[model samples]
Target: MARCVLQRLLLLVITMTLPMMTMAGEVSVAVASNFTAPMKVIAQAFERDTGHKAILSFGATGQFYAQIKNGAPFTVLLAADDETPARLEREGVAVLGTRFTYATGKVVLWSKKADLVDAKGEILKTGKFDKLALANPKLAPYGAAAIQVLEKMNLTKQLGPKLVEASNIGQTFQFVSSGNAALGFVALSQVFENGKLKEGSGWVVPSNLYSPIKQDAVLLTSGKANGAAQALLQYLRSDKAKAIIVSFGYDL
Candidate 1:
């Protein structure tokens, strides 16, 4: 009789726990390529803390905008520029007033060789390198900032032929990492952490050389019905997430 009672109590506990386990849901997020590393850290923490899962897709903000318009089922957008999220809000694709600036990014002219890039980025004027890599300006905000820096230094015309453009900031970083390009422009976050470069040498471009790269995040219409999506966005603004972002060399 005691054995029968114990078995009945164990079954009751298991049945009660099943409903709570199913409460955890998944959220799909579209993230900017520049934020890949930081987002990976944030996503893991979000899942651990809330028992929810985050499905991340990383690419250029421009490409994400196109995909969202074409009915991609994204629950949230973490864009490389504030403008992209603002536009989505105006177009009724994202929830109004749901947009918020997440981080401000810095651009850098980087090279894998320790001595290839100078502090002032004067190599652009010398035009000695065979190829200079940058993201496609039309598709990446970081690429646009890179162009602005070149134009400010009067090297645009001189370096035009030597330019190698990638589809996004992540690919632009890869070009230099693989040594296919002598040097390239990349997000500071890609090669930096704890206020220092992880590898290679780079010139942190002056703020005066280009416009601010204010990144933003927003909840999308497709995600409005998903509670997990809203929770993820809220978690991104929490102190824990902010610490991770700062650790990755981004400005809040």
Candidate 2:
């Protein structure tokens, strides 16, 4: 009968999907603020392709490190710098040999105004801006890189008073976008897409100006038993994730 056939079809569909439903799992991920845009896209693709969910928390790498040390339940960490993951591994908080460099970050002197920043970044020397925003160097690697750029140019002392420090690269970008500061040093990934600035103007800081911002991903001890967490870490190294990272102006 038609009714019997319909019931059988529904049962078959549920039976086929049962394995996938059981395999699907969720993982808690702590991500660096600068990687917000790309990570969102990657997380979406990861879920679509693998049936695993990533619950992301974005913040400064230093703050995340502190939280992880205090027994936060984060299953994985996507750090803005390599040191944090290495330290965590040494401290036995992270799974040994599971850390890998995910991306090399770049810094940019950026402004929301289209013509405010020149290609060569001479604006910093011109001192034309009232306030120059950056992340707190003590907690954010991007902020430390910004300080390095200033020191390399010998403008640290001269520009000291103009500095406005934010808690993280995200907040630093907010400060500039909100016009609370004229300009700020932020991750190039935050403002770039598909080989162009998404908006406003920016000067890409040269690599020689500061230490390489080698972002790394690691599985925390808390994630060792989590299949989703392990799968997510492996996914980060896949070509699809690398392409997403590259589109956002990060180097793999």
Give me the candidate number with maximum lDDT. 2
- Model 2 is weakest, by summed lDDT over 10 consecutive residues, at 230-239
* TM-score for each of the candidates: 0.93, 0.96
Model 2 TM: 0.96
Q: For residues 45-159, what per-residue lDDT tens digits would candidate 2 score against the true structure?
A: 9999999999999999999999999999999999999999999999999999999999999999999999999999999999998999999999999999999999999999999
**Residues 1-252 of candidate 1: C-alpha lDDT, one tens digit per residue:** 999999999999999878767888999999999999999999999999988899999999999999999999999999999999999999999999789999999999999999989999888888888899999999999999999999998888989999999999999999999999999999999999887999888899999999999999999999998989999999999999999999988889
Clashing pairs for predicted structure model 1, backbone only: none
Give lDDT: candidate 1, residue 237: 95
Top-TM-score candidate index? 2
Give per-residue lDDT, candidate 1, residue 233.
Answer: 92
User: Candidate 2: where are CA atoms >4 Å away?
Assistant: 1-13
